[model samples]
Target: MSSFLKVLFRNVLNGPSTDPFPLGETFTPDRLRGKVLIDPELCMGCGTCKEVCTAGAIDLSELADGSGFRITVWQNSCCLCASCRHYCPTGAASLIPDWHAAHPEEDKYVRIEQQTVKYEPCSNCGTLMRPIPAKLARKLYASSPELDPEQLRHLCPACRRLRDALKGRPFPVAAAKVPAEAQA
Candidate 1:
C-alpha cells in the first residue's frame, strides 16, 4: 500500500505521459510508414512494386499510345506493408511519414496516386525507350573516365552494348554529340 501510494503521487506530479495528438504537436518518427509515393524520375517501370504489393494496391500499365508507362497506387487498398519500398531496385518507392489518411466515403476512390513516365527516343537508333536514370547511370559507370557516362545514359540497351564492343574505337555513327573533352 505504501509503494502504491508513492507511485500514485509520482504519477500525479509527473502529469500525463501520453502525447496530446490531434490537439497539439506529436512525435513522428523517421521510419514511420504512412503514405506511399513513387518518384517518376527514378522509376524504372519494372512492375516490381505491383508484384510485391500483397494488398494489390499498386497497378502498372503501358499507356495506350505505347510511348510510356503509367503507375498507380490506390491508397484505400494499401495495407502499409512497405513491400514496394523494400523490393524496388531504383529506390523510387517511398513510404513518407504523412499519416493523415482519413477520408470520407465519397473521396475514398478518388484518393489515388498516379504517375506517367514517358519514353525518350534513343540517341543512337531513334527508337522510343526509357533511358537509364542519370543518377543511376553515374553510380554505375562512375569509375570509368574513358566512357562518356552522359552519352551512355541516352542510348538504348542495344546501342549501349555496341558502344561497349567498340572498345575505345571511333563510334560508327554519332549517337549524340560528344563533348569536346570526350572527343579529345
Candidate 2:
C-alpha cells in the first residue's frame, strides 16, 4: 500500500540498516563495567567484597602463616555487578573499562591478589590470625564505647568467645589461668 511504499522509500534513502560487521568500531557505553580491579595495598582482607558479590566470584583465603591474605576473583563467573566495589570500605575495589581476561575455560580466568600484614596474635593462646581491617575496627569501637579496643583487637574470635563464656565463673578453667605451676 502507500504506507508500505513510503517506508520502503525512506529505507532506500537511508542507505544500509546496519553498521559494517566485525571490523566496524563501536563506542563502549558509559558505566560499562568489564572487569574488577583490586588494589592490594588498600585491601585488608575484610571479606566485605566477598559477602556482597552476587555471583560469588570473590574468594578470600587467609595464608597459613597468618602473615597476610589472598583475594581471588573468578572473572569467568563474574556478573560485573560492582557490589564489591561499592561495599569496599577502603575503596580497594573498582570496575575497569577493559575486558576481563580471555580464556578457553571458566577455570582459567582466575585473578589472584595478595596483601601482606602482620597477624594479630591471640593474647591468651598466641594463635595467629588476620586481624579485622582498620576501618572495621574503628567502626566497631565507635558503635560500642564500653568495648576495650586493645582487648578485642588482639584476641581472635575463638579466644574472645572463650573469655566471654568463662567470665565470673567459679571453676578454675585450664585456659582461664596461666597455671602457677607453669609460671614457676
Query: For this target, which candidate reaches the highest lDDT against the unseen true structure?
Result: 1
Off by over 4 Å in 2: 1-15, 100-102, 106-184
Please, what are the lDDT tens digits per residue for candidate 2 over residues 1-184? 9999999999999997686645686566667898887876467678999999999988888778657677887777789999999999878898877763565655564454334455656666566565665555667788777776656766666666665677734334566344233333
Sequence-dependent TM-score of model 1: 0.87
lDDT of 1 at 87: 99
Tell me the RMSD of model 2 versus the true structure.
7.8
Top of the candidates by TM-score:
1
The per-model lDDT (C-alpha) reads 0.87, 0.71
* Prediction 2 global C-alpha lDDT: 0.71
Worst lDDT 10-window in candidate 1 = 175-184
lDDT of 1 by residue, 1-184 (tens): 9999999999999999989988999998998989999999999999999999999999999999999999999998999999999999999999999988888898978988899999998777777789989888888988987777789999877767667788767666564433222334
RMSD of 1: 5.8
Error of 2 at 162 (Å): 25
